[model samples]
Target: MVAWSVCAKRIALGGSRNWILLLVVFVVYTTWRETFPDAHSLKTITFMAKMKPQGANRPSQSIGHPKIVQDGYQKAILLSYMRGGTTFVGSTFERNKDIFYVFEPEWSLIFQTMNEYQPLQNVDGTFQDPVWIHDADETVERLIQNYLYCNISGIDVTSLRQRFMLEARYTKPLYDCVRMKRNKMANCVKNFTNVCTSKKFRFLKTVRLRVHAIEKLLTNDPSLRIIHMIRDPRGIAVSRQGWQEFYQAKMTFTFGRVCAEMLRDIESVEKLPPEVAKRVLPVLYEEVAENPESMVEHLYKFVQMPYTGYVREYVKNVTHAAKDNTVGFSTQRANSAKTAYSWRAKISWKLSSEIDAICERVYKKVGYLRAKSEQVLRNYNISLRDPHISGSYVDKFRQFRIPP
Candidate 1:
């Protein structure tokens, strides 16, 4: 009788353990089915799961981690204003096979927002005001964060259809897949995730976001870094004059707004904590064009990427390539340094002075010397950049006070 009682108790305990296991499996299967309703999505999830390290409880890096911990990869953003030579600077990363580069990922968001508002026009047919929404700042921040985290599936199909989204060399495969009639969009997104996660470095270049806007991302992701690119307002204004879309807009308003944004960005960087501040590196566009090799090396080091021989060769080829002026968006240049200052000769003395006055605070904050006279503006020998100006925000901010 005693032996039978012991056996009965053991059977009951084993049955309870089996019931618990079955319950857990049911919940997991049900959750996965609800989350990924399609077969392709289920396959993608399984593939991602298999790619993760053994015993890992977290989702794949493409889906994002709660906090970014470096797992043999780093993420970075090249932050700049429109026509601020972002294409030239971003090429340093884009040329490298080891880096996964996404160009102007924010364009989709910008496009969507712009569509909601009819562009206000002036009597002369130029746009009177910039097309923007009140919540655009927050929305742009979230979009950038999603891209950096490789949350490709979270992005809407409409956003993915933007022309600039297909411009990145790394995204070509996904772009091709998206165009196929039989291919599921989920599979295309899965392809993007696979390619993105396989790289040692993931990079994004954008002109839409502000410095303070990405503070949350910087604080949360230790592996993330920012390359803040600034160019002379005179040069930017001149460059915009060549582009019809911008030239149509009143030059004064466009130029003034650009400088205002630059000043605000400088202020935002100055207020960052030491830990967060150190991750931000300011790259002057003129300096980079002047010394491509050294600047590229410094940029790579700032982002913890290797400056390879191939990168050096690519820079040499692009900077030395025959100047292509036919295309407005061409990145090719015969003399990059010359191109940096070409705007000086293009703009009239009156225009240059007006721009200088408008961007005076920006020039002071960024350590750019204003062209005091027409002769000075036209003289190529005299450099407008202050040699003492380094990438240090504290040093730059020491000379000027923020206005009340």
Candidate 2:
């Protein structure tokens, strides 16, 4: 009877141990499935691998362990205004295979709020005024956080699609990582974060957000650098005015106001302390447009990227196209060098003078000529028609005029 009781007790204990093991496995699987779900399923990974660049034959960098990952990635933001040759500068980063480039992620949120009347809601679900939504100091902090994490949960899908398209060229590794099934869902999260965080260089390009919007990012993130691209106010004014008819309904301010914003943007940079100012590199559009190769080389050095033959060759092709001026939209084409001065021919002397007057502070600060040569003005037939600046409003030059 003693032997029989000992054997029965052993059997009961063994059965309970097996049940407990099975329960643990079940819980782990369920939690993982809930976390990642179907977006990164095995089937999707298989399809994406096949769709990856033709003849490419390498597995993605492992998401193996967080401790194993290196921590010296450089982050950069292209702070710019409309028609400031931002695209040309941004294209350089895009061509480099090493950089994980995010083009205007802020556009989907910032511009949408300004252009549309619909209230924007924060993560907390409270509806916010369109203009005031992103003005809060916390808004840009949240933007930088989301951008670094490679997460797009807060952005509107439609705005992202319309403004910036993520091609297969950059997203191959992201797709490839979903193939790892050992740790399943944990791998999915870690792999995505690892892939993004492991990159040596990460760039975010934005023409919409002001320097003040991202001031905190400079103070907090030691790796973060700001490339503030400024064009002559005359050029920016001309570009915005060119789009006047198309954006008839959206005009909320006069031409002087447009120039005021340029000064305000420069002031935002000036307000930064010397330590913060050291991180900001101001690029003049004229310098870049005139000599893209040299400017790009200098910029590459500033960002700590080695200037390679690949980048040089790309610059040659781009500048050559700009010199040739083959396309209608110079900004879109290879000939941005020529486009930089194209504004000089388009705007009248009076309008240019108005922009220079309103943007005098910025011009002096950036070392730009306040006005074009009188000879050049004569050649371009500088006459002011006093056309409506936007939506039946005339230029505010008269209102803000200073005594000569």
Candidate 3:
């Protein structure tokens, strides 16, 4: 007790070095409790010794619900890179009435940052250089956490007023309410919170955040799950070529970064503790496209959501369009399976080979087969996907180091 009193006094006169003393005190208390199992008085003394007096600044707690008590609600993030077919995947959740879906909540922050920084752009107006933002990871995490917790006020009011940010079906009420009288906005936010909290599932799809950025959320919130979507670099490159917003002088640098990010994300997931890691589901765009129904079923099972006939029909309708929409950002597909590899038909041999070489490590890690010749590149019959290779293969490649 005397020793604990001394430690407590030292803690009260806190400095950075006091953390070491706190650690020592914790170890001693834990060891003492284990040795003397019935030392109830010691436990109380230790607890009291650690308590701070009034007016002391408390340590900030992690945002989100405790892992043990999420109250049967599920929170999910469809974490992917841009042009990675997230829109198609996110549509599944969006169409579901039970889910309160938020589409790219981080866009507001990214938009604001881009406007402030005035990042370098290509002749075509594409962001050629990366934008550096202060505390980007922290800000993104906070935005996501606020949305998951339904703390609308924590999000910027400017973001809330953006029509694009509120495009999710569940957010339509708030969108309409925001455009009305200023006084009514507060009431709308409250009503939105009520609706958000009442849902069985809360989902957000973000292309801006990497897998590591959300590791804290997974560690702290058992209900939070990650659908880590990755697409073939070739396909992504081809897709970007069609999109004006993503046009560049050449795609080599951009595509290289995409693969690198994917590799890093895979490695990040591998390093997570087993319990936390299990909450992340690594999905391939090709696999999902090839077998939409089956993949959707698996995805639904992974998240513990029921696979209803309605969802099945929705998937069929979306994936089996009569004509493929040529629009850059369109999610509609005439034949989803073919669309997954349509890049083979569109990409030149030179570009394909270049991308193949650039993303070779990524291909091996994620189990994609590289084309050896122009004929093979254009051949739709020969699948680029390794039948044996799937997202579950992440465990097998952890020993390999990412190239510099």
Per-residue lDDT of 236 in model 3: 85
Assess each prediction's global lDDT (C-alpha) against the native: 0.73, 0.58, 0.73
Estimate, for each residue in 1-404, the C-alpha lDDT of model 1 and write its tens digit. 57646655665688887666656666876754442222234445356445533322323123233564555668899998989998887877988889989988877566545433323232122432222465456556767876776777766554454556666788767767766769878778888888887887889998877887787778778889888899988898888888765363588877888888888988888888877777887777887888887778878877888778998988888888876552755678899988999998898787788888999888777788888888998999998877676754535432222111
Candidates in descending lDDT order: 3, 1, 2
The TM-score between candidate 3 and the true structure equals 0.74
Between prediction 1 and prediction 3, which has the larger lDDT? Answer: 3
Worst 10 residues of 1 by lDDT: 116-125
- Candidate 2: which stretches are off by over 4 Å? 1-70, 112-137, 151-162, 166-195, 241-244, 247-254, 322-336, 372-374, 378-404
**Preferred candidate (lDDT higher): 1 or 2:** 1
